[model samples]
Target: MAVMTMEQSTSRSILPAAFRTAGVDALAMIVAMVLAALAIYLFGNAAMQRVVTYAAIMLTAVLGLQIFSGNTGIVSFGHAAFVGLGAYATGILTMPAALQRTALRDLPQFLAGHEMSFFTALVVVLVLAMLVGLVTGIPLFRLSGSSASIATLALLIIVYTLLVAGREITRGSQPFYGVPREIGLWTAVGVAAMAIILARLFRETSFGLATRAAADDERGAAAVGVDHRVARLAAWVLGAVAAAAAGAMMAQFLGAFSPKDFYFDFGFTMLAMLIVGGMTSSLGAFAGVVVTVLVVEVVRRFEGGGVIFGLQMPVLFGLTQGVLAVAMILVIWRRPAGLFGDRELNLLRRPNAKMDPVKPATDVAPTRAAAGPISVDHLSRRYAGVVAVDDVTLSFEPDSITGIIGPNGAGKTTLLNMIAGDVMPSSGIVRIGAPVRQASAFRFARAGIARTFQNIRVFPRMTVLENVVVAARVVEPGLAAAEAAARRELARMGLERFADRPAASLAYGQRRRLEVARALALKPRFLLLDEPAAGMNAVETAELVSILAAVRSERRIGVILIEHDMRLVMNLCERIVVVDRGRVIADGAPAEVQNNPAVVAAYLGSRTARARQGNDVQ
Candidate 1:
């Protein structure tokens, strides 16, 4: 049994042992979900059920936020917009005929005349939320951090205003009552289940890995062929659907709703839960929901929505939100990572995981029967009028190791960036022979163009094994399966001994090796190592070479070695491409390239220096 060390920014996952079975955690999840459903079914009046349904709705909605904002380390304040759209869409489209006669009289012409079943309306609203995200994401796509946050707020305001001011369609800003409470307990549970499934699956997917990587360092992720925008957009749409589902469910629970329901207060509350629970884990979101909801329930039971603190007024109009606010502040001050950080919770109590041995990968020797060689045709990249790569063309044969070497400003990294599709070439095409079709950074890993960086970019807070597993996520099916595959990669890199150790805690050389392990997990056809030998001693560098050799032999994956350490490059590469100021100066075997005057000038400034370094190095 393989396992990652207990660490933040990662989880311990396992493959399905038999019949594609769920693990202890998954079974526990199933049991808990079933129990909650049963409790809602057996006990409780219509009102209690309504309360539970509301809680579930909030849980589902916040789960969406956690997926992108929490798990992926990006913040989005635009979630409420999604909820608002879903509610109005569902309300306007599915309002009961009897109530629609009076309530929707002033509604917009389009929705006023049209009505659909509650289920149909629900699905439609979810889709509508996605459409809204897609339509609006164009402007907000390139943003991150504070700028992205402000844009999200803008999105929220725009949607809120549209719902409120569009009187003809929304009954705008006015209270929308007489909405038949048709959302049943079972239905809400089903939706919550769906939300959990989606969140769980995505978090466990390769897309989720890329999302996290991109969040940690955009440039590094792009160099590895992960598209920054597309991954984020997918997260946005998924979040929108979940938010819409929550809103639609809320409308059914309330039996009526208004524009104010989709206000900043709601956003704040969800954000609070997201923060208090732990920003990047699904468990954190759900944990926050549990804590927040419990606080509210207790407060309402005692203070009746207000807390008794000496002579002052109640803590909250309703204790649920007010106490939750206090808790949020307290939690943020103390434990900012939230409940589990990036770790996932399983059924069994966790273990001392760092020392665990490795498990088996899906395939012993991952063969790329499809993709042939990767070719770069006259690739050029320019940034702000500066040519980063100029008319550089290179080819990486399948099952062969090649090296790209140059001085700091010679455009070695730029050329790799262009090949990976991180920086779209100014003029030229990157073609992959055989099964690989076209060149896209996002599809590179699956197409066999996985890579590592000079500056380590593994999931820092995650365990060493988790870092490896994260890389294979794109190639495998789910978290469990990916973990199984990653174990093999980690073992190959001689990192199984520290599988559970935090990547951040590893020495610099260890982190570098983990980076290589991660790239290997991708089952890539072509692997690029960008200064993998940097900051390593002779022993570490030799270890890296051994790992590289093993990778080529085991997986038959092509490799692009980018390094300043000429010794390592000469020792590992079959063909070497030397670039000087973004143009290839020499291309041939290591010894031949070393003898080139141009290569020598670029690396050592002249032939004499090369001879000196060669003697010293030998």
Candidate 2:
């Protein structure tokens, strides 16, 4: 019963409320990183300093993994290849003259003669890794779940094979030496800090928000106009860059390494750090790195028989590996969401903040005049031997509500899906102002066509307002404007009360209204609703009808509604289209379609000749 007004959702600033809040989280991270660096520099011994540097490098790599895997909820095992690429690229470009002359006799002519500074080497490798990420991510990221994981593992094997086979470049399994030991404690710390900031900032960006939305639900995000491939690719490239930079630093730190250095061992360790701390938060990644480094150091000391106080600790066989394995297991078993989950570190709250009542949108909203009427010309869809929608032709007028009604197994949903670009029409054209050149969900949405799924597809992890904001941003230029638009739309749907709540937390009816609000946020020319009133009760149905009427009247947008509720359709629609099996049977006013003989026969079965004539009809 509590509603979040516009004033409550935003403050007097150009930045959106969400971004403003993220600034505080960023500050917390900055403070923690600076303090940790200071502590290492002031009190640590030489061994401690080296350990800190190594930990920082690991943190950078883990943060990279966090960006792609954590945000997109897709695990990647190929970042190890990126690490190797960075290390090998740096080594090849900076090998000492003597070593290069002796070991790289058959190396590439340009590479054999070059020796670059550490900074220059780092940049080159970073760019190279990102390029690799872009090329591989296009096809690899297209797969999801285990398929994507397997593809990434295949990439690791491919890179390993290339490194092992390229004797001239990588020395063919022999250690590549003569790399400059340039990554000191302070340099590693500085790079790690910068990487952390970049990782955290990316997560707060609008693109990041959209990527997370798509991760939560693909169909839902596409309906809101999110392009999944583009978002995923962007993250993948950035992540590769981070991992590459870390690898370059590690190369300089170790001074010599083999292909095995950047293989399964390194990749799994980074993944474990990410998962144990929390994959979704930058703070979690940082914490995981710190915890794992300490654990490994302690175990390493025990492995070599360290003297503690007056006692001698005997050497232990495989203790470090066993401890790390057990820790990873316990972490996964107890907290799958990670220690911090998706929360950021924040220390203070402004208790004096007030929630002011907001005025509903009057004429402040911008107009979407270019979105004209939509026309479907002979749209047909066939699956194998069955025709889901056969030669369906319909034109939805501007500022009007058209309802599609049919019995079970009819083509209503299929036809709607085709128009929304979720399903491709076997043969026909869908013209929205102009003939759609391509039938894609995002393209259709960009062309001012928005839709809601038959089954609700709200981003379960995102807040109700965020769900609308993601869609609104497709049309609005700025995040601030999108937030404003989303708030207004929520208010219009009476969803303002649940604005701050998670979309998954809302009641079933509220989720339906949230979907409508999300669709409207696109400023669409045509709004397609597929059984929007599917599970609603009498009162909810009436309210939905009113809302649709308001949307059509206020926005001057055409609406195509697919509904099974006869009363709701009969009362709310101005024009009705009826379909039987896969073809349109009747189209006219509600009353005419309701009494059509074909409609009756489709829904209630055909009548006998005597019954039709009303002569002693049984």
Candidate 3:
């Protein structure tokens, strides 16, 4: 009934989204900059810079884990190993020992004993980590949920073994000297900034959401065309590169190092730091590193000789680590997601709820074009030899409102998954218009198709605006594009008012609206909505119906609605498809499909009720 009130619809070529420029993000970044400046001003000398640089490197590593673990909802035990990869690679290329020895035998002898610059060494470390990531990532990326976590642990073991066994290359765990101590405050800060920016962009993208969704529910994400393998690989390779960067920074700071520096001790050290620092926000990584490092240093300085309960005690450092670790464990058990979780801080709320409406956009990527028609032909999907959908054929015609209704065990979801390319078919073609054999999840999305889940998958730690912006993740690959696109989508969904609120805080109806808005931002030729009206009050359902109708008519984009709300279905669907047990039972206009005895009996459980409704209406 309501036509977006005024002009909530966004401009086709919008600038950046309001969420990308959120007042909070600017304030937080500014705070970081200010704090960095303050630290430099107070110390401003080599002594202090050397000390802070190591702390910064550790924090950067923890931040990388936070991205791979905290926001994406997958725990990585091998991040430290990636750091080792960087350190060892750097040591081999730049250290005097490496220059003196013709190790790696296969590598050119000229390269050995040839002193490489810090910049070159840094580049080599990152590249080596990336290459290793590409190979190791394949197996980890193929796994789903908790299983993938176990695989990463295996990866850590493999990496550790390689480093320790390669005596010739790594000097048999001995100290590799002549590794330049060239790291400084400015270098650490620059790398940290880059790492944080990359992480922020990943978190704000669809790839980030898909990672979480897979962790939360793999099948659900795949149904929306989110390829788990590719998403995981992107996270792994990037996270590995980050780890290498952190390791290089650490090596530069220490100036002398060995393979043992990157073993379990280092891994545990980084893990504790990440856990205490809040593991979900980039800011948390910084906080955790500073706090943990200070705590450990202060305790070690005292040598366990502290007064507890007015009694002098020994082994204070031991007590300090134990207490710190326990505190972190408790925080996690009680508030599993950590202080900030995956959300960026907001600083411009002005202390009034009303002023919240004027908050800025906070997206890293956004789409620029509207979608066209989406077509799926002979699409099918299978799981472990069982065909969920077999050679199914359908199309969401451009600019039409279509509905698909089915029972619990029907193949409606399976078909949707194939179109989205979340699940590759045993054999079939799926394309918006062209004939194709198969496509990647990102590719499917890029080809102009977007969808929502049936169970309402929201990123719990993210704000409403963040959720939308992150969905626009795949649409815009960089910071500026994502920012513009997320803003335009937020306004369209009427969620501009609730932009900064955490997703878990929103009412059920609002969450549904945000999910739809995220899909719309993809600017798909067709939108597949799975149960948009599920579990809604009458008022809420009515609101949703209006919103959907307006979108279909105004956007000129076809929609495939998968819902159980009979009233909403009858009212909105121009044509309906009914299915049961992995196959379509009937297809026709709502009235005709409603009258079909088989459809009523199979899905609604009553033809008599349908007859009664028809009679009453007449």
The candidate that achieves the highest TM-score relative to the unseen native structure: 2
TM-score of each: 0.79, 0.90, 0.77
Instruction: Give a tens-digit lDDT track for model 1, residues 1-618.
Output: 233233211433434321122134444554576687688679857667767777778888998897778645768888987887787777778777767878777654566645587888887887788887788776787887788888899989988888888876777778877666788777877888777767766764557767877777676665455676878888888888899889888876776778888888889888988888887876777778777877777667656433345554543455566777888888877887776666666433233554466554434555563477888878888888788888977777888899988877878887886676556678888886543234466666656677887668777766676566656666665666666677777777777778666677888888888888787777777888899989999998898888788767767778898887878888889999988878998999988987898776666574566688899999
TM-score of 1: 0.79
Stretches of model 1 off by over 4 angstroms after superposition: 1-53, 107-124, 127-147, 182-190, 223-225, 297-326, 348-400, 406-408, 424-440, 443-446, 461-484, 497-502, 523-525, 553-558, 575-618
Name the candidate that leads on lDDT.
2
Number of clashes in every candidate structure? 19, 0, 25
The per-model lDDT (C-alpha) reads 0.74, 0.83, 0.70
Better candidate by lDDT, 1 or 2? 2
Score residue 239 of candidate 2 by CA lDDT.
88
What are the C-alpha RMSDs, in order, of all predicted structures?
Answer: 6.7, 5.1, 6.7
Ranking by TM-score: 2, 1, 3
Candidate 2 root-mean-square deviation in Å: 5.1
